[model samples]
Each structure stands twice: as structure tokens, then as C-alpha cells.
Target: MPWLARSRPLFPAALLTASWWGKVLEGGRAAPRNGRCVMAPVRAVVRLRRRVCLQRKRRVLGPPAGPEAAVAAGAPGPGGGSPGQPRFFTFDDPAALPARTPRKRRRRSRVVLYPDGARRCRPRAERRSSRAQRCLLLLVAIVGFQVLNAIENLDDNAQRYDLDGLEKALQRAVFGQPAAVARIVALLRDYLATHVHSRPLLLALLGPSGVGKSHVGRLLAGHFGAVLEDRSLVLQYHAGHHCPEARAVQLCGDELERSVADVVARAEAEEKTPLVLLDQVELMPGALLDRVLGLLQPQRPHPFQNAIYVLLSGAGGAEVTRFVLQNVTRAAPGETQDEAHAGPRAHQTDMELRAGLRALLAGAHPLWQAAAIVPFLLLDRHSVVSCFQEEMAGEGFFPEQARAERLAAQLSYYRVAGHEFAVTGCKQVVAKVNLL
Candidate 1:
């Protein structure tokens, strides 16, 4: 009872000691009042003490260790129950023990032993092998393809001019001058392909009065004027018409400068190229030629530099006629040009003729020095006949070949080297055709 009031917990030995004290103090020899024995009081007190000690042990240590561990060690515990009895969670229960936490293990590489030494290599991450050469080849192929494509495109720049049409027109219009036509077309094809030019193209068409120089000029002017779709852009500067004997040279020069400036400036503003045709340039005064030459200078502005200047002059006519009569072979009826101006010899003669003409003109005026001199050779009787037929056809007349031959026979010719070179070429064809 005292232990209950105090509420102090004790071990099983303390309980037994407490019970014995109670027995000694209250002398378990008490007389029985009714049928109860004095030993009954002592037994009740012993039971109460045992129950208190059991509660103290339960509080001190959480559900103890498993009974299997004690049994394995061959030690009998206070509550190591037999296998047949169902195990309760107690100081002997294996299930009641706290679980152990698992730990992460670090990986260590195996030692690589060699005859001479030992080495430790760290594990590497997996990776694909390099294909640098194959990659380089693929890159090269791509770049080369792009470069080749770009090269092919550069040739396409000359396509817009319809050079084929222009070539055909020149061939048909300018007879007895296939080489000249080809040269003009070639030069134009090269120049018009791209807009950016270092200096203006100076074309000097040097020939006599009858040799289709002015005709070519007119054809070109018409073609370009039509192509550009702007008549104002084509500047036709006829030396005889523009700068007459009555007009002052200085005033003519001023007018020429202003007109050229206006045309080039307007064309440039419109992002277009202009053609400046100066026909009968030989008749042009030196003062005017100087002004024109000044415009052709490299230092000129972009507008002035981007234009084309053609000089149709009869300055080297005598030299051209003399060369044709002396060096050129006679015409064999249908094959005069083919027989005379054929093969490499004809090419050499043609080159020499042009060089001579260039030298002759360069002495007369410094303008010719910078120009691309295209000498118009004397036309043969066959070319003159063709010219007559062309003019007749153009003038709404039936161009009968026999009638054209009869008409061409009327014209005078320089009979030399088995060929009849026309003295006045197709110059008289237009007049003759008009009469028909």
C-alpha cells in the first residue's frame, strides 16, 4: 500500500524485499477473523509488488531483444517462451528490433599490374570515335559545289541584251562586213553584261562614205533606243549636222557638253545606260573632239563613265581602200569573201588592217588612241548586189535576184585581183532602190 502511494517503481528483488518487510512488520501470525488466513494478506502484498516491478522494467527499456538470440547462445531469459506458444512483442521479440539502414558503397578500380609497374586508370565515359577526315571531305564537297555554281552564274549576266537578235540584225543590215558585225556584237556582249565599267566604251567606225559605217551606227542606235525603250537616252551627234560651218566651235562644244551631261545624268538617275553616237566624227572640229575626249577620261564621274560613245568617221577611208586593192585576193564570183578572207591568213590581214588604221587615226586625233577602231573594209560587187536586193525589198519592191544583178551591174567597181570591189559600195543602193 505504501509503495502504491509513493508511486515509485522497483526491480523484482526490491519487490520481494518490500513484501518480506511487510510480513515482518505486520507479523503474518495474525489470528483469523472469519475463514481468512493471516498468510493471505502477505500473498496479496507480494502480488502487488511483483506487478509494480514489471511496469518499471517495461518503462526503462523499450520492447527488449529477441528470445531467439538468447536461445542461440544457450541462455534462458525471463520470458524466452517455448516455440509452440505464439510470440508477443517483448524484450525477446526479433521483429521488435530496429532495422538497420543500408549504406551506399563507393566503386574502386581494379589495380592493373605490369612486369615493370602498376597503374590506376580512372573509368571514362563512353564516346563515339572521331571521323575528322570524312567530315572534312563532306565540307570540301559542299564548298566546291557552291563555288562551281557561282562560277556558272557569272556567264548568265550577259543574257538580258538578247545578243542573238542584235547579232542577226547587224549581220542582215551591214553587208560585206561579217567580221565587223561579229566584233561589234562581241564588244557589246562583253560591255553590257555588267553595269560597272572603268571608262566609257569608245567605238570608232572608220571607213569611207559608201562602206556601211553610218548604216551600222543607225542600226545600233535604233536597236538600243528600242531596247532601252527611251529615245531620249540615245544621243545622236552628227558632226556635219550639229556643228555646221556657220556655228561657233566653242558654242558647239558647250552644247555638246550640256547634252551629254543631261543624257548621262538622266540615264544614271534611272539606273540605265545611254548610247552616244557621234556620226561623221572626222568632220567634227578638234575643239569638240577634245570636249568628247574629256568625257572619256577615266577620272570622270560614274554617270559620264557608264555611257557608250561611238564615232562614225570617214577619216581612214583611203588607207582602207588602198589596203583592200593591194593585199586582198580577187573575188571568184560566189566565193570572193570565203576565198580571200578565209583561214588564218585572212585573220592576220584583218588584224594588220585594223592596226594600221588605228595608227593612222591616232596621229590625226588623240581621241582615236583610246578608241576601239573597227575599220569598215570595201564592199565587193556581190555584197553590193545583196545591198541592192535588201534595199529593194525594204522599199516594197520585189527583190528579183536577176533584176538586182542587172541593177548592181550599173554601179562602177574597182576590178582587181579577179574581184570587182565596189567603188561606192551600197552607198548608191538606197538611191538606186528609190528609183526602182
Candidate 2:
């Protein structure tokens, strides 16, 4: 009776029916025990009747609010039972559902108070100290000073020998032999870089007679003449001109020895490296080559040690000609056009050529073993035309290209690989220009 007081007024019939069931279940009585009212064993069954009465009351009225509202308004729960199945206070009842409560995350606090923004973090320490920075600066300064000194020293040495002028003059005078000119300049640069020397520098200009070997010899003599400020310091001896076949061999040897002795003595006194140009050395006697080789030895006088000897010989002319012909015949189009891409191949070819010439000449004369061999290649048709034009201009002509080409066409050439190479080179250019 006390629990029936909670029954809704809108569901009087359901409440009354459920109350009758609750009374039957409880036997409608609370027994007196030890002078106190006590609940009967059927108290649980009475509570179940009350819950069922509530559910019936909810169905008669509108659905409850919140999670229970969906349970009341929606269809029956899963595992819908038959009419004979037990229906008292099962989880399938719509009014028994509980409301959902989301779980809370266990997050830590991120915010904190700081006295000052600038000092909020520990200051990052430098990897190096002030003393280390000073040492690094001092090292940089010393390295820079050393590099500058080396560069200045190189420039002074090069200027002392006038290498720049010599390279330029050789380039202007010599054509179709860029490798030869470059090697010659590089050798001179290396040798003249320092005043001290272990032995003399002997550069053998080996090529066929008209490939500007003599012209290069002349240019070197002229340039060194102005640089040394003493014509006596430059000795240019032509075997064919200075010592003819009619002259006694002993007389010629003595004359050459005396001239070299005087030049070397003067150069040593002046503390300079004299230039000795020996032209047509292929025609020179064996005794003369021995004498020249003696001067290049370490046991020679101090003056001999400080001199530069250039031997222009035609001994390797046949080899140089054969090498050029074979190259022209076998060379690919790319080999002639793309030099940068074919650098290794070209360098290999040069090494082979130098090796071949060295082997050939070294066998003939021991002096050539120590000499720097510069091989002059054959001149092309264009270089021959240029030479013709140059000779013409020197002879006070207009130096017309068409006229020069016409003159160049008269010369003989060895045609190979769709190109023409002058057989006589620029040797006959002077004679042809003089006739005009």
C-alpha cells in the first residue's frame, strides 16, 4: 500500500492491477518481530510488481525524457520473446534503460607561470669559446698571407722571363700547332718559376722542316733578346748556316764550344739563364751533340747549370708526318669537333706521340733522353693561307684572303679524311709572296 502511492494518476487501471499483484506477492502484511514491523520474504516480488506498474504507466502516458525516452518510444529490445516467455523485469523492458555518461580523459596540465619571457629557458651555450674564435681568425689570416705570397712570387718569376709575351708571340707566329706552343710555354713556366736548378732545361723542338720550328726559334731569340737586354745572352747557331760542310768538323766544334762558353760565362756573371737556340740539330755532327750534352750535365760549370737550351731538330720529321697522316686518316668527326668531350682520348694520343718521339730520338742521341720534345703537327690549308697573307702583308701587299687562298692553292698537299694538309707547310710562303 505504501509503494502504490508512487503510482501515476493517468494510469489508474494499470496501477490498480499491478497493486493487486504486489499485494498477492507480499500477502498484504508486514509481520511484527521483536516489537518492530519487519519486511516479509516476498518483499522483492513486491518491488518487481511496482517496476512493472511503472512501465505500464509510461506506455499509457508519453515517453520519458533522456536515454530512457528512446527506449520507451522505440521498438522492443533484441531477443523479442513469445507471449509464454518470462516478461517480468527483463532488460527488454523499455523503462529500465540508464542514461549514458561519457568517460573523462586523464590529460596533464601544460600551462605554467614564468617570471620573465627572455629568461624562460636556459641560454644555449656556444660550441666554441672566444679564444677558439680568435685562433680560427689568426689561422685564416696566416693561410691568406701564404697564398698571396705564393701568387706574387709566381708573377715575379714569370715577369722576370717575360713568359706572357713569349707565349703570345709564339701563338701569333705558329699556327696549327697549339699543343706544341702550349707545351713549350708550360715547360718554360715550370723551369723559370724558381731561380735554383738541378740541371739545365733542354727543349727539343722536333718536327718537319717547314712547320714553323725555325720561326718559333727566331721568336724566342727575339723576345729573350729584349728581356735579357743583351743580345750576347741569346746564342742562335744554325748548323747549315754557321758551320757548313766545307768547314772542318774540328773547327766547327771548337767554334760552337767557344761561343757557348762565352755565353754561359756572361750569363753566370749576370746571374741570368741565357737562351741557347741550336737550329738544324739533325744535321749536327755526333761530336757537336756530345759537346752540347756535356754542357747540360750536373758536373758542368755553374753557368751551364743556369742556362736554357732549345734544340730545333728535324730528326723526328718522318715520325711526326706519319703520325699526322695516320691521325687524319683514322680520326673520327667527333674527335676533330668536340675536343672537351674527347679530352681523355686527345691526351692519350699526345702521350702516345710523345712516347713514340722520345723512344725514336732517345735511341739516336742520349741528350734527347733529357730533352722536352715538342712535336709540331702539319699545317692545314687555312693556316697556309694565313701564312701567305701574313707574308704578303709583310712585303707591303694588301693581304687579300682570296689572293692568299689562290697562292696557297698552288702548294702541294696530302689529302686525307676529306681534309687537305700542306705538305711543305708555310715554308714556301715567303718565296711565293716575294714573287708577287
Candidate 3:
């Protein structure tokens, strides 16, 4: 051992320092020493000691003794991860160490944010606001729908107005059955629609008393957007009165006439439709009708020709009486009566009326003819009932069916020889009474 100890100093300094110098030195002493100083054996012992010390030192001073450390230590040698480690590493094998498994990540839950739960709930104020908005939208929709409907109705040609009321009023005046009244209405509507572009000149409504001629004329005026006036009304306007009067004036004032003229002038200037519905037109002098006829005549390219719709409502043959009285009354009663017997008298009267009508027609163009003349037949018994029923639909004052039957019966009684005249020459009689 002493001899081997002497060779301990020959061991590598790396082995001695890495493996703990004392332990490395002690292990080296096992080497044999010969009298001849065998350097080969000593060198071999030194090499082994140096390798052991290096490994021991690396294990002690390197990373901690964990899986990571083992992996780092067991990593590929100087070349790479192949078969084995250095021969010196055979003494220390830590390859049995377990590997580290990856850690599982925890998930965080999400939080929902609701600022005001009360508002989210159906609060009274919110509900009220929503309801109000809905109602406003509904109202707007309704108004828009109504406007569109009105425009469409105005454009429709197939649409018809309620004529039952008119028929009842004219049941006595019409000359035919109630059913004929429908045809009259259709004709009247067609005429008005076609003649909207014409002016008033010699327009006349020839029918008997109680016929709806005056009434229909008024309605036509309304349709034309006309301002209407009668003889009395005209006289009132001439009396310097701005409003209608209940009575007529005995004396005609020039100033009042001028005022009436002003009104007419203003009506003309304001671009309004002027229509005079003379109910008792026969009362007026023949000269007046003649003048009216002259005005009614369609004028070619005449300015303000469309501004008037002369509405003369009179009983048939009434014009003849007025014509005679008007001219005869102007002369001495005896002289006028004597002239009335002359053949020239009837010729003159006919010429005069024709002249007036001709003058009016002259002013009116062909376009005005359709609208200017509306000769209507009166309603019959059944028409009277139908008209009454229509009127009853509104005012809850009467039973529609019963009232219509009663009116029809009364109208039937009034017709002579089973024939009735239309009240208004404007519309035809649709209802007829079969007395049998």
C-alpha cells in the first residue's frame, strides 16, 4: 500500500479534484509498483481516477437532482444521443428517473353585465312609451291609407253615388218605372264626367213641377264647384246686401244693381264656376232665357266661357206662356192680346227662343253640348220607396223599408194615367210603379 501510495501523486489532478481528492487518491493506491517503475500501470490508474472524479464532480456541482437535471445530464454526449455514455459514467446510472408531465390549465368563467334590471323588466313608463309609439305609427298608416283611397275613388269610373234619395223625391215627376232611374243616374254621371271641360251658356233642365230637376242641378253645381244663385238671391245681391234676404225688394236701386254686378264680376275674376239654378225659370221673361241661351252657346276659343253653367229648371210648355206674357204685357193689354192671335206671333216667339238658345249655343263649343243639356225623366212609385230607404239609413228617425213602401204607395196615387214625370231633368227615373 505504501508503494501504491507513492504512485497516488501520479493520478490526474482533474480526478482528484472532481471525485474528492482523498477518495480519488485512496482508489489509486491499488495500482502495483515494481522495482523497475512500470509507468504503464500507474498511468492507467491515473486515467481511471481522473474519469471517476470528473463524473462525481459534475453530479455534485451541476443542476439539482430532479427530472430536468437527469434529462440535461443524460443528454447526448459530445457527438449526439446515440448508444451509450462515456465508460466512466458506468459507475453512476440515473436513467431510471421519471419525466415531468405538462400541467393542466384552469378556465375562468365569464360574467354577465346587466346595469338596470328594473328597466329590463316591463316597467309602466316603458310600456306606455312603446304603446304610444305603436299608436302613432298606426294613426300615420291609417291617414296615408285614407288619402290613397280617396284619390283612387276619385279616379274610378265604375263607382256610383247614392241615387235612392233623389228617386224618392222625384217619384211623382218621372214618367217611368223606378228601375229606369238607375239608367238616368248613369247617363248623368257620364255626361258630367265628359263635360268637365265645358263652360256654361244655354244649359236648360226641362221637366214638370216636383221633378228633381232643381235638386239635380244643385248637385251638378256642387260637382262643378260652382257658386249658385236664384232670381231672389240675385236681387238681394243687387240690393247691396252681402247676405241672402228672406224677401224681395219692390224698387230696383242702381247702386244695388252695381253691387250685384260687382259680385258677378268678382265671381268671374276669382275663376269660380257660376251657376244659376232657376227653379221657377218660366217666371223669367223669354228675353232673359234667350240671353241665357246665347250665353250658354259654346263659343270657339272664347275666354271665360267655362266660367258659367246656366241652369234653367222649368216645367215643359212654361216657356211659351212666359214668352207671350213678357211681350204682351209690355204693350197695352188689348193690343198685346190681339197680336198674340196673329200667326206671326207664334213664329216670332219660336224665333226668339231659338235665337236665345242659338246665341248661347254659339258661345259653347261641341265640347260643352254633352254637359250643357241634361233632359231627365221623373221617378216612379218603386223609386220613391228606394229613395226613402236610403235617406232612412242616416237619421234614425224612420224605418227604411217601411218608409220606402209608404212613399211608393203615395207616389203611385199621384201619377195620372199610370205615368209619372221625373222631378229633375238631370237624372233618369229608375223606379216604375206597376199599379196592377
Candidate 4:
């Protein structure tokens, strides 16, 4: 009764009407009336009734089987599911899920090889140093090449011969041709003054052999600081042997043309005029003569605009000499002066000589029309004597003036005649003096 009195107040009036409540009340009546014991059976009976109620509720609503069931029952899912937990759908076969592509692995680069079969893994500093060295070598080579070219082009002897020196040499070296010397000096002056023009100064030296035609060319080259012996700036071509044929193949082939062009181009680059001496020009082939003439034409493209071309021809030497001798003097009856005093007469004679020579050359070849014909006069007995004395004096032969004069007179008497002068001019005289 005491246990019932303690338990009856704690149980709800609704649960007291249940069978387990009725059993708990019957057990309470069997206990001692005065004892405050036997409440353990009542507590067990209440726990069994609560478990039975939970089983009945599970049967009615069904246990949670999926994510939806878990969410609806408010039960915690995987990974700490709370009230607002995000539910993940589970696939039975993992293949049903979207596939994840595997990542690509990076490949290592291969080493490069050098020309000597060595690996090319040079450091940055070493590579830069090698590049700088190559550049330096190239620069040094370029500078050396330029310096050599400049040195080769410079003419050391050019400044040694002046206009005055040129005139003195012409007078001393070339004898018995006063008119020729004057004309040459004048022509050179004119050429130097007007060389900037397009046309070249063309001279036709017409006379017999050994008449200083080639000698004059040599003197001019020497005066201008050109190499006379080596034929660098002075191009000498003897038609008969040197230029054997008109055809390029027969005349040393293509090499000859290249050499000529190279010389002219070099002279032009140096701002100097080149001298082209054509010896025995009359003997050259007509085709070759025409080609040479074409270079002087105003409309043609040629490297000889700044050049001085001397055509030495013995073709009409006799005719030239006959003309000079006939017109040597044109004095009046009262005038006993020499040919030097007859200024007007001398001018007229020169004009006639040039006209005659021009006519003769024009008859043989048309190229002579562009040239100024200059006659190298034949040396007289007096001029021959003076030439012999000058040459002997220079050579240290016949040092005494009186002895030299006597030897010169004897030589002139033996070698020269009254009407016919020395054909070889001073050439044979020099050779004889050398023998003495």
C-alpha cells in the first residue's frame, strides 16, 4: 500500500488504466502495508511498456532504409549529419558515377649534342664569352682588310713629281722635240684643269719608232706618281704581240678583260686618272680597234672618262716627217729669224700637221677623228749633239766640258746627216753613250 501510495502520484492518470499499470498496482497491494519497499518490479514493468510502444510505432511507420528515410525520421546520417544536413545519393555500382580522368605526367627534355659529339650544356656565362670572342675576331679581320686596302691604294711617289719637275724631266730626258714638249705640257695642263668633265683627253702620238712616243708616256706616268715598270696605273698594250688577236679567247681569254676592268675601277675609286697607252695601234685588228674607240664615245658607258689614252702609231710616220720638214720655217725675205720667232707660221704649221695626220689616220681608221694628232719631230744634227752631251754628263762619262763637246760632235757627225736625221731619235744615242 505504501509503495502504491509513492508510485500512484508519479504515474499519469491515462497510463494507470493500461494492463502494465494494473499489474504494477496489484504488485503494490501484495507488499507489506507498513513496508516502504518492492518498487523495483514497478520500474521494470514501466520500462517494458515503453519498449512495446516503440516497437508498435516502428511497425506502423517502417524503419529508415535510405537517405530520405533518415531525413524524414530526423536521424543523423554519415559525417556528423545535423538538422540541416546535406544528403548525398549513394550508387549501388560505382560505375554509375561520373568517371574521373587521370592527370597527365610531365616528360623530361633530352640533352642536345655538339658537333664534336659533346653534350651542349654550356653555362650562360661561358656561352656569352664565346659569342663575344667570335664578334671580336670578325671585327679585327674587317679592320685589317680595310687597312691593307688603303695602304695598297696610297701612291708614295705621286707627290715627288710636280708640274715644274715634269717639264724639267721632259726637257732633259726627251731631246730635239721642242714643239712636241710644249704641246704635251699644254695638253697635260688642259687635262688637269678640265678632267672633271665626261670626255677623256685623247692624244695620238704619230711618228717613226724610238721617237720618244713611249718615252713621253713613261714620263707622264712618273710625273703623276704611277708605276711605269709594273703597269699598275699605266696600261701598255702592244697590238702585234701583246694583244695577239681580236677575239677574247685568243687574247689571254676572259682574264684580260677582268684585269683591265679591275685596273680602271681601282683608279676611278682612288679619284685618279688612268693612262692607257696603245703601242703599234695600226697593227691591231679592226674589231678590237672599234671596241677601244667605243669607250671614248660620249653616250657610251665606259670607265675611261677620267683616263688619258695615247695611241702610238708608226703607220704614217714618213708622211708626218715629210710634212714637218717642209713646213719647218716660213720666214719672209727680210726676216732671217729662226722658226721660233715665226709665231703665226709655227701655229699654221701645227694646224697643217694635225690636219694631215688626222686625214691619214681617218683614212685607215675612223677612231682617229676623236684624237689630237701630235707629231714627234725628227732630231737635227745640233739637237742630236746636245742630247749626247746631256746623257754623257748625267752618266759621269766625259766629265771635262771640252772633251765631252768633242766626243758629242764626233758622234753627231757619224750618226746624223744634213737632210736625213736620226730615225731612232735619242734611243741609239743613249745606247752608244752607255757603251762608251
Best by TM-score: 1
Residues 94-144 of candidate 4: C-alpha lDDT, one tens digit per residue: 445444444467998987556886666768886676778899999999999
Q: Candidate 4: how large is its RMSD?
A: 21.9
Candidate 3 local lDDT, residue 18? 44
Tens digits of lDDT, candidate 2, 4-74 = 45544424544555675587679875434543213332344455565566566665664554444534544
lDDT of 2 at 360: 90
Q: What are the per-residue Cα lDDT tens digits for candidate 1 across 249-336?
A: 9999999999999999999987777999998887787888899899988788888988889989889999999988887554344566
lDDT of each: 0.79, 0.78, 0.43, 0.64
Which residue runs of candidate 2 sit more than 4 Å off their true CA positions? 1-151, 330-344
Per-prediction tally of clashes? 4, 0, 50, 0
TM-score of 2: 0.64
Candidate 3: lDDT over CA atoms? 0.43
TM-score leaderboard ranking: 1, 2, 4, 3
Q: Write the per-residue lDDT of candidate 3 for residues 81-167, one digit (tens) a residue.
A: 434343224334455544334446798888756686444556576666577888999999999999988667554522332334444
Each candidate: RMSD: 19.2, 16.9, 21.5, 21.9
**Candidate with the larger lDDT of 1 and 4:** 1
Runs in model 3 lying further than 4 Å from the true structure = 1-199, 224-264, 267-272, 290-304, 317-372, 412-436
Q: Is candidate 1 or 3 superior in lDDT?
A: 1
